[model samples]
Target: MTVTDQLSKVIDKTSRLIDLCAALQEENDLLKLENDSLKLSLESREIKKTELEEKLRVMTLARSLEGIQPTELGLSEKTLDIKQKITEFVREIDKCIVLLKK
Candidate 1:
C-alpha cells in the first residue's frame, strides 16, 4: 500500500478509538453516579430500619408493662416496679446508642 494510504487508515483508526474511549468514559461516569445514588438509598433504608427496630423495642416494653395490675400489687409497689422497668429500658437504649456510635 502507498504510505499516504496507510497513514490515512491509521488516522481513521485513531479517530474511531478516541470516539470509543469518550463513549466508554461517559458510561463509566454514569455508572459511578448510579453507584453513589444506590449507596445513599441503602444508607437511608438502614437508618429507617434502625428507627423501626427501636420503636419495636419500645412497643414491646410497653406491652409488657400493660400486664401489670395496679389493684393486685398496691399503688406504691406498682409505681416502684414501673420506675425500675423504665430505668432498665433507659440503660438498654443507652447501650444501643453507644453501639450505633461505633
Candidate 2:
C-alpha cells in the first residue's frame, strides 16, 4: 500500500477512537449521576426505617404499660403521674424525629 493510503487509514481510525471515547465519557457521566441518586434514596429509606423502629419501640412500651395493673404494683396513687410522664417522653421523641427529618 502507498504511504498516503496508510496515513488516511490511520486518520480514519483516530477519528473513530475519539468519537468512541466521547460516547463512553457521556455514558460514564450518566452512570455516576444515577449512582449518586440511588445513594441518596437509600439513605432516605434508612432514615425512615429508623424512625419507624422508634415508633414501634414507643408503641411496645405503651402496650406493656397497659397490661400492667397499678394496684398490683402497689402504686395506684402514682399511676396517673407515670402515664403523664410517658406521654411527655413520647412527645419529645416525636419532636426529635421531626427535627431529624429536616
Candidate 3:
C-alpha cells in the first residue's frame, strides 16, 4: 500500500479505538452508579428488617404479659418467663441480623 493510504488506515483505526474506549468508560460509570444504588437499597432493607424484628419482639412480650394471672400467682413466675422469652427472642434476632449482614 502507499504510505499515505497506510497512514489514513491507521488514523481510522485509532479513531475507532478512542470511540470504543469512551463508550466503555461511560458504561462503567453507569454500572458503578447502579451498584451504589443497589447497595443503598440493600442497607435500607436490612434496617427495616431489624426494626420489624424488634417490633415483633415487643409484641410477643406484650402478649405474653397480658394474659398472666397477677392476682393469684406471684409476679416472680411471670417475670421469669418474660425474661426467658425476651432472651430467646433477642438471640434469634441477633442470628437474623448476622445472616443478613453476611
TM-score of each: 0.64, 0.67, 0.62
* lDDT by residue for model 1 (3-95), tens: 999999999999999999999999999999999999999999999999879866765575478686555556564565577579889999999
Weakest lDDT window of 10 consecutive positions for candidate 2: 69-78
**lDDT of prediction 1:** 0.83
**What are the lDDT figures for the candidates, one per model?**
0.83, 0.83, 0.83
Q: Is candidate 1 or candidate 3 better by TM-score?
A: 1
Q: Please, what's the RMSD in Å of model 3?
A: 11.0
Evaluated at residue 84, the lDDT of candidate 1 is 58
Q: Rank the candidates by TM-score, best first.
A: 2, 1, 3
lDDT of 3 by residue, 1-102 (tens): 999999999999999999999999999999999999999999999999998798667656755676764445465645756866887899999999999999
TM-score of 1: 0.64
- Residue range 1-102, candidate 2, lDDT tens digits: 999999999999999999999999999999999999999999999999998798667655765767975556665545655765788899999999999999
